[model samples]
Target chain A: MSDLLEARSVSRSFGGLHVTRDVNFKLTTGDRVALIGPNGAGKTTLVNLITGDIAPSEGQFFMGGDEITGLSIPDRVRRGLVRTFQTTRLFANLTVADNIALAIMQRKRITRRFFSSSTELPEVRAEWSEILSHLGLDRLAYRKVVELAYGQQRLIELAIGLALHPKVLLLDEPAAGVPHDEAPRILEAINRLPSDIAVLMIEHDMDLVFKFAKRVLVLAAGRLIFEGSPDQVTADHEVRRAYLGSYADARRPT
Target chain B: MSDIAVTHVPHKRNIPFAQEAAGALVILALGAIGWFLYPDDLAFLTRLIGIAFLVLSLDLVTGYCGVATLGHAAQFGVGAYAAGIACIRGVSDPVALLAVGLCAGTVMGLISGALITRFRGLPQLVLSIAVGQLIAGLANKLSWLTGGSDGLSGIEPGKVFGVFGFDMYSRTAFVFSLGVLVITFVVLQRFVRSPFGLMCRGIKDDDLRAKMIGVSIYPRLVVMYGVAGAVAGIGGALTAISTGVVGLDSVSFERSAEVLVMLVLGGAGHLWGALAGTVIFMIFEHIVAAANPFHWMTLVGLLLILIVVFAPRGLIEPVVLLWAKFKRKGSAV
Candidate 1:
């Protein structure tokens, strides 16, 4: 399949520190990719570069063929490049439904209608109800985001990402702060995302990476060292030495 | 998940449908109380109405959009001068003057908003103060056009609609100001509950997330600044028209600070809170200033301290809480 998103030689550095270095990757429709890396490996930075949160020092990113390096963060999101934070960033004071409704309003471009009630708008009501319900969060719709459990907030993050109608969704550790037992529900929600959209998850959880990602990309010290199927990732000698060596050897390998 | 009929949300939605109508009624009721209590002092009430617009406008940018400003009177002053200049040049109709004020305010809002939205937090606040001082200075310097520091006079507004002439009782000005306030309140109430307004709240709550969700924060804030400007402009125009004079006070730095005080006194963010703040602050100021001519400042200071200490959110939050409690008790019974 043709690429939905492509980052060509994308690199970023803060002063002398090379946070993201010459990382080239392409995501096709329905691609399930988990990006695994050690601390300071620039996994989140790569996501930021693609999302237009930070600019690349040398390289360009494209969505379906259009160079999006020049676009603003919101404009890139408008073009269907969306992401969720490692730490849940939600409208903490607003209800869950309102948070989801904001994404829906932006998607439909109804955020400019200034004379009607937002909640009573039939289209908004329908969208949030459906989206939240699908994520099994309809029960928490009226609750303020600040009042929600950490795992549920993460689920709301996924719900919001889904609401944006993203073509390429970058989830930066969707279950990072989630309790051990509740992490799977978040994974379940992640699995339930629309099939046609490409999903790139930045995760350290090997079990989740194995289960959710069809292919795994390993990064170490700001470089793409390996990109292969989950099975092949452990077998690659260089990949084992640089980063996944101890974990892979411990999990089930030789 | 199959058995869950999740379409119908069970929680009681607090977003009332009759908000605009209810708001209009409340404003009218407030106007009537002012009318009865201070029948002879209609000019005082009219002045309150004029300042109410400024407070409401302040609420729009500061309370709703999350843009901290100390220079809101920049728009209010521009609007006053616009209406006053338009009238002096021959726009005699009251409605026409208000329109001039609205356009001028919106333009001023766009200009100031463009500059102010560039920074966040303290720098933004300082920038707003600078903008206000700049506008007020410009007004003071333009003596030929604005009557300089002496204030602009010779503003003779024709009949309300070319039929209802302003009588000696100051009845026309009071009623007109109140009518404008009620209409603006209803409209702003609607605006606050709309998608655009909610998006602004999203920005106020968390702008980065708003941007991540595809919200263009700058443009929305600029547009809201324009909306806020239009509201403040109308207030300035009303002040000029009702009193038949315009001066440096209209665009003064103190006017910006005082309007903000009023918004904070009543509440910020909620439309009614702005109106409530204006009423409480003005009335308390009036009564205290009357009771103690020399030490009036101390009393007002005490009141502000009391309110801020007891009700950090604003004067309205406690009432709203009590109201919610009262209703719950009623429902329980």
Candidate 2:
């Protein structure tokens, strides 16, 4: 099967400090991959490269097949490559429905309208309602984003990403800062994501990562060191030595 | 940015057109009261209508889009000249003059907005002021066409539907202006609640998030600027129609700064706030200048300081809070 997204030998550096180096990956339809690493493993930089946030120093990215290196962020998003921020970036002063509705309206190409009310539009409400309720955020439809819990805001972020009709969604730490009790609901929401599209999630929580990802990619010092099933990832000696030493040691069959 | 209010779109939408309808009624009532109270000062009332247009236009970019602009008078002035010159060169129909002003204002808006939207924060403000100054300089330089600093004169409007004339008492001017302002308010009332306005508000809150959602922020800001220009241009045309002349002061730096003051004083985002600010500032300026010509500015300044101190969000925010509070209370009780 053709890859939905492919990054070829992507590498980026700042002066002498290398941020990403010779990273390569491909995602096919329905792939649920978790990218885990230490704090500066250039995980986000790789996602940025894929989403066209930052240009690669020496490699290229392709959506389906065509080169997307030259495309602007919006163009990339238009082609169904979308990303959520590590920190929740939402329209704080706007209501939850309006926030999700913005993406729906943009997708419908009705955002240029002047005569009809944006919130009153039935089509817009329908799209946002489905997306919000899919993540169980239908109750937050009228609540301002500011009044939402951090967990709810994170879900809203995912809702916004979903609203763009993404074929390949890049989620940067989907459950970061969420309370432990609320984090599972987020995991459930992530699990509830439409199964047809490919998802690459950057996460530090191994439990959530192990639970959510069918396949796993481990990065250490700017390069992907291991790519396999979650079981194999924990068994790999190099991944253990580079970053997952304690976790792997604890799980080892002595 | 712990308290980042970059995306602060204030009003919530629940009842659809009901809120806008009530706002329209309040404006109409206020305009009517102004008519009765200022029977002898209809000229001042007409001037109030003109400046209100500038404030409304400013609210679109600065309030909705969060695009800072200090030199908005570029569109306003260019529009005034377009209408005044059209009338002088014999485009005497009131509606036609307004169209000319609108076209000119839209062009100026597009040109300046295209450049201004490229920058953010302080640079955007600088660029806007630069554009405004550039247009004003061009007006001064093109002396034969614009009559330099002396102003453009001999503009004779051919009346509303060729029936009512602009008499010395300024009765027709005030009524005609009121009609135009009311219609503009209704249209804009619907407009701010439109998808375009909502999208712009989203862009205002966090443009990066907006981009991630497939929005092209630059073009949206420019188009809004063009819309603002159309309204401001009509305002300029009204000035030409009612006063029978357009002057350099119509597009002056002071006028731009004054409109900003008025918009900020009333509130930046809300449509009603724009109108209220213009009315309050203009009437206060007129009345205080007439009664206490020497220290009128002092009282105005004091009033402004009081408002800004007590209501940093603008005078309208408190009223909006009270109204929202009242509504919540009504629902509960």
Candidate 3:
């Protein structure tokens, strides 16, 4: 099977420090990959490179065999590759439902007519209601996004990503600021999503990285160190020594 | 179990009809009153409406869509020149002149919009001002076509629909100008409620996120700016019809700035705010100018300063606040 996303000899640097250096990575279609790394390991930068937010200093990125390294972020999204931010980006003044509806409308043919009604389309309305209902956001549909709790805002972000209808969803620390109690629900939402859309998730939580991802890739100091199952990763000696040593005892639930 | 069930059904969307009819009635009443009274200064009032329509166009782009434009007067001038040049060449039909003006305005707007939207922030404003100056320069250089600062003259009001001959009287002009204003206002209202307008709002709020969600900002702004130009072009042609002349002042920076002030003074985001601001600013200008020439500009400057400092939402918001307070007081009593 071929990888749905591929990076070849990707390296990016700022000033003297080498943030990412000659990293090669791949994710097969429908692959659930967990990227685990210590702080400042260039995990987020890798995601940015893949999504075309920043060009690699040296290397190429291909999505479904198409060179996407030079494409604009919006054009990359239209080609079915998208990335979410570490912090949520929702239109604070718009309603939760409107935020989703606006995303869906972006995919349609936009004309220059002064009086044509784009919102009156039945399909657009149905998709809006469907996304809202599927995400359990029906009750907060009309409420302003700023009024929602932090967790709810994160869900809105996920809903926004869902509306893009991307084939690959890149989540950058989605559960970072979410509460302990609500984190599982969000994780469960990701777990329950359809298997067609490949997910590349960057997380610090060992349990979350273990619970949801089928394949694990570890990064340390902007380099890919290991790739295997969670059990194989937990049992590796060097992998345990370099990063997982601190979490060794904490890996098992009390 | 003692209560009987009842059903409620909508009686045919009365709000849209009522709003439309009320707007039409107001315009008609104003026309009838102007015709009967035949105020000696009715021409001035008709000219005010024409200028107000131009300001409304500026308000839609700058206020509603968050497009920072400093050169829309170029569009107004293009329409005026197109219509004037057409008339001077014996193409005296009003409908033909209107179509010509609209086409000229649309082309100018699209070209300028494409150029300006490529650059962002202060660069956008600077580029627009440069485009404005470019048009103004062309108008000055094209001496034969534009009359070269001597000003275009010998314009006759001709006839409406080639049937009712327009006379020196302001009655026909007033009615025609009022009809155009009502139509423009209704179309703008519907536009702001549509999905395209909503996406523009989203773009204004956050361009990056809008892009992430697949909203292309540049092309959208270009289209909207073009539409706004078409509307303002009509306004310029209307001004030509009423005044029977086109002057360099139609493309002045001061004219553009004054319209911006009217928009900010009326309120942003609300279409009626633009209309209300135009009306108030025109009335204010008329009263103050009548008192003294310098007093008109100075008074507008002072009023704008006060509004910016005290009530930045414009006069409409303050009026709404006061009305709400009065209602609450009456209910308490």
Candidate 4:
């Protein structure tokens, strides 16, 4: 199967500290993977490199087998590589529906004629209704994003990424601050997403990671330490010593 | 960010159908009464309206589009010069004046917008200032045609479509300017309510996100700036035709800053905010100057600082917020 995204020997450094070193990774079609690491493991750097947020110091990255290491962030997104920030980046002043609507509107041309009457476009309006209804945000669609609860905000972020129509979605941290009950729902939503859309997420919650991700890759201090099933990841001595050391403590509600 | 929940107060009042009709009728009636009663002052009032229209254009760019411009007056000056030069060279037709002014303003705005777009932060502000200075200097250096500091005088604007008999009595001039001002206001109000305006607001809030979604910020901002410049150009042309003079003051930096203040004082995001700000500021200036010109500047400065600090949303927003607060207390939402 063709890899949806691939990064070969990608390395990045901030000054002398090697944030990411010789990090080779690939995401196959329909693959769900988790990038697990302790604090400052350079998981985000690897994601940034693959997503074209930052270029690798000495490596190649590809999307659908085309070199995209030099593409701008927007250009990369246009090629079906999109990402979400760990910190939710919502338009604070705009309503929830308007936020998603903006994403839809920008996907088309920007002529005065096209833009002048976009609000009434039949297709656009229908898509907006469908997206909002699916996310259970139809009631608060008109409310400003800042007024939404944290959980709702995260869902809105997910919806925004979905509206981009990306082939590969890179989620920085999907369950970072989600409540236990909410984490299951987020995982369920991810599992139920269309099979064509591949997801690669950086997560700290092993429970949620094991539940959703079919394949897992563990990073330790800027290097790939383990790449296997959830059971293999838990049994690996180095993975247990480094990442799962606090797994038992994290069992408590965050 | 805290929700001061109290009641469901609509953004506007829900008056009875009859009451809404009556309110519109009353306003029109009063306007008619004032129109005839103050015929002599109509010329001044009309000129004020034209100036207000220009400020409204600035409001659209700065307030709506979130573009900080310091060379807007240069665009206004380009319009005045285009119209004045056209008139002196025998194109005394109003339509010709408007066409030339609008085209000139739009061209200048697009050029300047393109030039300053690549620079952000302090560099962008500096580039805008430099653009204004360059245009003004060019006007001054091209002395023989522009008439330099003395300005283009002896501009005898012909009657509107050669029918109104635009003599020095100024009656036709006032009516013509007023008619143009009202039309411009209607057209601009529509423009703001359109999808383009909403996209401009979206860009203002977050240009990066807008671009990620596929809206290139640069091209849209340039087009908006050009439209606003074209509108402002009309106001400058009105000033020249009605008053029959164009001076260095037309392209002065102070003029640019004053229009910005007018937009800010009225309200940043509201359409009528610029209009209200222009009217209030002009009346205040006129009243203050009649008593003591120097003291009026100081008072205006102090008042602007107070407004910026106390009512950061401008005069209109504060009033709306206060009204909302009171209504919330009264309702049981």
Interface RMSD of each: 0.9, 5.5, 4.6, 5.5
Worst 10 residues of 3 chain B by lDDT: B4-13
Report lDDT (CA) for all predictions: 0.89, 0.87, 0.78, 0.76
Candidate topping lDDT = 1
Candidate 3 global lDDT: 0.78
Task: Score residue B140 of candidate 4 by CA lDDT.
Answer: 87
Q: How would you encode candidate 1's per-residue C-alpha lDDT over A17-60 as one tens digit per residue?
A: 99888999999999999999888898988988898888899999
The CAPRI class of candidate 1 is: medium
A235: Cα error in model 2, Å: 1.2
Q: lDDT value for candidate 2? A: 0.87
Q: Candidate 2, residues A1-254: lDDT per residue as tens digits?
A: 67999989989998889999998999999999999888889898888788787898898889889999999999999999989999999988898999998988888889999979887587777677777767777766777899989999999998998888899999999999999999998888888888999999999898998898999999888989999999999988888888787987787788
Best by DockQ: 1
TM-score of each: 0.95, 0.95, 0.88, 0.87
Candidate 2: tens digits of C-alpha lDDT, residues B128-150: 88988888888898989999988
Clashing pairs in 3: none
Clashing pairs in 2: B7-B205
Order the candidate numbers by DockQ, best to worst.
1, 2, 3, 4
What digit string (tens of lDDT, one per residue) describes model 1 on residues B1-333?
353364756544354646677878888888888788888889888999999999999999999988889899999989999999898999999999999999999999999999999899999999999999999989998898999988899888999978877766678999999999988988888888799998899899999999999988998999999999999999999988888899898888888888888888898887878988898888888887888889977877788888899999898888877976886576457
Q: Compute the lDDT of residue A226 as modeled in candidate 4.
A: 87
- Superposed model 2: Cα runs more than 4 Å off: B1-17, B329-333
Q: Which TM-score value belongs to model 3?
A: 0.88
Candidates 3 and 4 compared: the better one by DockQ is 3
lDDT of 4 at B75: 84
Which model, 1 or 3, shows the larger TM-score? 1
